[model samples]
Target chain A: MADITQLEAFVTQVRRDIVRQVHKVNSGHPGGSLGCAEFLVALYQHVLQRKEGFNMDGNQEDIFFLSNGHISPVFYSVLARSGYFPVEELNTFRLLNSRLQGHPTTHEGLPGIRIASGSLGQGISVAIGAAAAKKLNNDNHIVYALCGDGELQEGQNWEAIMYGSGNKVDNLIVAVDLNGQQIDGSTDTVLPLGDVKGKFEAFGWDVVTIEQGNDIQAILEGMESAKTKTGQGKPICVLLQTVMGNGVDFMMHTHAWHGKAPNDEQLASALAQNPETLGDY
Target chain B: MKTYIDTGKKDTRSGFGAGLTELGKTNENVVALCADLTGSLKMDAFKANHPERFFQVGIAEANMMGMAAGLTIGGKIPFTGTFANFSTGRVYDQIRQSIAYSGKNVKICASHAGVTLGEDGATHQILEDLGLMKMLPGMTVINTCDYNQTKAATIAIADYDGPVYLRFGRPKVANFTPENGSFTIGKAVELQEGTDVTIIATGHLVWEALEACKTLQEKGISAGVINIHTIKPLDAAAILKSVAITGCVVTAEEHNYLGGLGESVSRILAENHPVPQEFVATQDTFGESGTPDQLMEKYGLNAAAIVKAATKVVARK
Candidate 1:
């Protein structure tokens, strides 16, 4: 197990990176990035059993796919800090000729990204394929994917959800960032995703809910528990209940900041809350 | 004149199935996926032999496309089978973002293309698939002529390292190509040589163009015939060389005139050498339910149409 204090500091530093990267470009989806800070930090720091270097074909490693790729700020920061690439490369988050695209893509030869996923609802299906490949190779490592709750509105997600359980893709675990917020408005106002847990359960998934998604200990514990549910006949779904903007006080609990960057004063105030846990990029 | 004999008659989709079965036995990295059309797509032989690699996606084309793109991550060569309409138009965005833009090695093998998908009407018959696929960057578009060529192209695309769109049809046409021939990408095959006019054809129209050549011979018109299997990365050198010898050209295909082989040939001719050209294709109209023979005649995509276009273009020359 990893130290809880170190994990918490990693999450704080990730939050700072998310805000700073988006603020520098003055364009990006920061709300979901902030919300997914703890989950991503815990995933890279404590959860996944990774190999030494980055290669396109992850033969036996625990591979991850970011289906909702708009939140690349958090994904890039976590990957760099976890030693996938140089930490200072975070300065080229969405710049010209940078490997870091606005969405996560493998086109630029990025080390961590295995697929291009900005169009939404594609990650789960891709994860299922990778999981199937793992089963074919007899590789016991698990395949993980993260998606947004609002992205479920795409009909493709339901098709993948139906396929995951029907085909018995047991080596896969899908986690939904159930922030209840989208670009339009609250999920309820825009399109109510009524009973998301029930929906997954009805689709024959072994479902679990992480009630405190923003907490480092809760996410780590929940992910550890979810890992044990694999190798069974059914796939697993972790409905992580997170705030749209989790760490910062002003950006939380709303959909307005879903794709907006903070201004000068707002950036200073947001950075003050998290402090500088591990030197800024 | 160089004469060719028809070995047999077989549906192009069966050739795809035969090639897939060969791949299943040879390449362990090759995997196949279908959208609940295993029997229609003739993938039963492969599925029966290797059930572990065969995935039945069950009527969800979008999911199948995404999964195929995903399978490429672990260095698996994925081949997705379905009708041309669902393979290209329905799940285009999935193919564009996940497969084409990402530069994954995926072979989108499509069957039941053009008006020859008889009785299914315009919805099932996709005439615009070539244009849609060729427009995307880094996409290799191939429309094979016959059964033997289709099988060879299917097996050949596996070794090529990029996304490919292999289009074929349902009806059993002429199988004249060699049984064990080498299928090279972006190379045109010259069937016969003449000096009056050039007759370039693709897909079902290649056989029709050959028949037109015979009739034009009787009328004292020596016509050149070329088989263009690969539409994109077109053999412009072969086209320009043939047209330079033969002053005029007649392009034929079982597709719309706006974005089929005819338009591609015209573009090459206009840039390099402007020549009088006539199109033997459907004139911007949707096809209705009819027999394959009747639809081919009604759409003016037969040997008679090709012969007429060749004679008219030669007259202008």
Candidate 2:
């Protein structure tokens, strides 16, 4: 295992990247990005077995799709730091004529993204397709997907849930960023995702819930458990219960921060909580 | 006029089944998914023969579309089988983002298209499916006339690496085309050659156009019949050649006169070759619950309608 200190430093720098990118663009969903920074760091640094460079086709390597692509801040930050693209390009986050848009997409011929996924609840389906493709090609590589808990309210997600488990898509590992909050309010207030775990279980998926999705160790264990559960003739779903804004003090536990960016002072204060480790973009 | 004979009446869905099974035997990457409509979609053969590749996605068409788009990521050629309404309109967004926009190699095999879907009424009968699918960028839209053509299109779409919407009907109709005819996209098949007027048809209307061609010939009206199987990436060369000779056109389809094959042809003619054109299709009205024949006749999609359209176009010419 790598040093916890180094991992923490990486996660911290990822958050800094997210803040700097979103703050510079003055647009982007920062809440979930910040909240899921540690989880993303843990997955990229430890959980997933991806290649050093990002390839769109993902021929022989494991693939990951950000279904809730609005949380692109965290995704782009993680991807850039993990060596998908240049760290400097994160500055173009929502800029006109730049590959980096407000949401993650393959439209701009983005090096890492294989499919466009700004439309919520569609990523899991794409991930399942990728996993199925892996099985067909005899690639044996796992496919990972991350989606927001609130986005699960889309009927499309349930369709994916049913398709994945029904087809025995066990090569896929799907994690729901159950921050409990969305753009409007708490998930219960917007739409009660009643018994999400039970729902997935009933749909024939192997369900795993991470109580501390924001913590590196907890996220790592959750993912490890998910990996062990693969190839069991059932798809896997991990309910990651994390704070809406994970690391930043002012942004945490608030729905307002779900898609909102922090001001300069707020950005400075947030960056103070998470020290630069991997060097900020 | 071109002389055409019907071998027999067979549901186009059966042709899809036969083609899918044939694909299974030849290609390992060919996978099929049905939204709990395996029997209706005639996918039983594929499911039974290639159970490993066949996926039953339950009643969720949207999810099924998304999954099909996803399956293409790993280099699997996925064919999603469902009614036209569910395949295009119901899951357009899923198809838009994952399939068309992402440029995944997927075959959206839609059965029970147009008013010919019959008895299901307007809810299940999607007259706008052709338009909906054709409007998407990088989408190849095709409507096969008979079982032979449906089978050919199904097998052919598997080879074409892009998003394709292959539309066919549920009812049994004419099953005569070359059993092993080479299917080429954007190439119109001249069923009959004449100069008085050009009768262009797609889907079930191809049979009607053939029948109309015979009737028009008996009436001393030399009508040229062209089967435009591929609606998008339209065969401009064939259409212009036929229209150039006839100087008038009659477009036939079991779809809405608006945004149907007629409109597509009109748009092409308007831009490239100006010609007097008539449409044999459903006016802007919803289909009612009726037998397939009754619905086709009521919606002005029968051979008699095509004959009338040919007469009018010939007169104009």
Models 1 onward score TM values of: 0.98, 0.95
**Candidate 2's residue-wise lDDT over A100-144, tens digit each?**
888877778767788888888888878887787788778887999
Say what the interface RMSD of candidate 2 is. Answer: 1.4
- Per prediction, fnat is 0.63, 0.72
Q: Against the true structure, what is model 2's DockQ?
A: 0.69
Give residue A142's lDDT in candidate 1 (0 to 100).
90
**Per-prediction interface RMSD?**
0.9, 1.4
TM-score of chain A of each: 0.99, 0.97
Task: Compare the candidates by DockQ and give the number of the best one.
Answer: 1
Positional deviation of residue B84's Cα in model 2 after best superposition, in angstroms:
1.3
Residue B157, model 2: Cα distance from true site in angstroms? 1.2
Q: Candidate 1: lDDT of B231?
A: 94
Give the per-residue lDDT of model 1 (tens digit) for B1-317. Answer: 98888888898898899999999999999999999889888899999999999999999999998899888878899999999999999999999998898898999999999999999899998888888898899999999989899999999999999999999999999889889689999999999898999999999899999999999999999999999999988999999999999999999998888888889998999999999999998888888899889999999999999999999999999
Going through the candidates in order, their DockQ values are 0.75, 0.69
Off by over 4 Å in 2: A55-60, A272-275, B314-317
